[model samples]
Target: MNFHVTNHTLYVGKIETLGVASSSILQIGDTQCISLYSMFDTPPESVIVGPVAPLSPPEGAESAEGEDDRNGDAEPESSDV
Candidate 1:
């Protein structure tokens, strides 16, 4: 955003592109911070959500088509266990 300060008041904004910011600069109270901006060469392609690719399926390796995720065994715990 372009900040126009005439007596600490905004007057005009000349934004060309309209999209979410991957990064930004912020001033909060007495602290100042800057964010890193990044973008992909092309936006990701969309996928069809139909019976073939049903929504809310099990994630990760168990998500293969026609695979049975439940193997009649309790899930394994990580190091925290």
Candidate 2:
């Protein structure tokens, strides 16, 4: 397994002779982790992990005040509402 450290957390992904192959995300609060595995019939290889940009809030969301004219971000926070 290989580890990639980001500004916020770490990530684990698969690597190959060509480069990184596939990756699955694992997160704990703001941290991240991933594990790499090899098949019994396959030979061991080096895996590279890289950083990724953090995601941003959805677009059209209100800054803070509730003044959405289009109601784009007016959805209820919970089903009880």
Candidate 3:
């Protein structure tokens, strides 16, 4: 198959799909990548598959808002100068 190359990137070809989701094998440099093409810009709320691997968080969840939760909840107290 002849791949179209442009701007240091190669457009291999369009991949056919039965669902809304589609994918293609793009040759970006030396790597042959499997790129997923989705009609939705972002993912759905929750994706369920198999016995595990839920992509979304559970319901009624709070956003971290850029806060780090790695060490658990903590508060900064006023230090004596």
Return the top candidate by lDDT: 3
Report the C-alpha lDDT of model 2 over 1-20, residue by residue, as the tens digit: 99876675557596335454
Task: Give the candidates in order of lDDT, highest first.
Answer: 3, 1, 2
lDDT per residue, candidate 3, 1-81, as tens digits?
Answer: 998866654566876556542554433356654557557455673544678653466565575344465586644463322
Taken over the whole model, the C-alpha lDDT of each candidate is: 0.52, 0.51, 0.54
- For 1-81, candidate 1 gives per-residue lDDT tens digits of 998745564555655555555565433234445548787565444445456653565667364665343784544453232
The segments of candidate 2 whose C-alpha lies over 4 angstroms from its true place after superposition are 1-17, 21-31, 40-81
For all predicted structures, in order, the TM-scores are 0.21, 0.16, 0.15
Task: Give stretches of model 3 more than 4 Å off.
Answer: 1-28, 41-58, 63-81
Per-candidate RMSD, Å: 12.5, 21.3, 15.3
Candidate 3 accuracy as TM-score: 0.15
RMSD of 2: 21.3
Query: Sort by TM-score, best first: what order?
Result: 1, 2, 3
